[model samples]
Target: MPFYLEIIISVSLLTGGVFLLVGSYGLVRLPDIYMRLHSPTKASTLGITGVLIASMFFQSHLKGFLSIQELLITLFLFITAPVAANMIAKTALHHSNKPAEKTQNQALMDTIRDRESPPSNSIK
Candidate 1:
């Protein structure tokens, strides 16, 4: 392998390792459900992406043809991370004790319910 390519791969691996470490730390240390989402969803994403890029580069250099397994896996990870995160967040939201009233989303439902119901205080 060329010296420059080795350097690039080394840097990529180093950066990816750092990102993975940070992401794991954040997972352990971050507060709250939403805040914790930032760590795994964002850092892990970039970290794993770097690893995938590194793998692809290293594989291609060694094999003389593009190796797409890592690329496809990376694509799948990118596409699925958000969904998995969303599911997690949704589950947390569903189970959490956080006040539903604070969201103001209930206001929309309130209005809809009022529209559908006969007003009790409408000065009948």
Candidate 2:
């Protein structure tokens, strides 16, 4: 309703749109799976968070009360995005039948191998 609130919502929506676009572009243009994972996980999370914030602002301004659903969704997205990305990356590494040039990190390789193999010692 007010000029400043309208400006805030507009800016937030625009920023979210821009971040989402960048993430989409990265998914298409990046060379490898590992590189591609960074885009959607990081940028998209920020983008969604921004959009959700804008929604909360707009709704509160309209209804004269703060909305909780948008806050919850934003919180869920922030918590889950990185975890989902990690799982996808791990799955990719596991199923990569061919040696990928991009997967050169020795620590990651070691961690995946460790996860695959059974523990040597049993907890009696």
- Against the true structure, whose TM-score is highest? 2
Candidate 1: worst-modelled 10 consecutive residues by lDDT = 97-106
Stretches of candidate 1 above 4 Å error?
97-124
TM-score per prediction, in order, is 0.76, 0.84
Tell me how candidate 2 scores on lDDT: 0.84
Candidate 2, residue 91: the lDDT equals 84
Residue pairs with colliding backbones in model 2 are none
Q: Write the per-residue lDDT of candidate 2 for residues 11-123, one digit (tens) a residue.
A: 99999999999999998988778788889998888898889989999999878999888999988988888899989878877876344476567466656756755576854
Model number with the top lDDT: 2
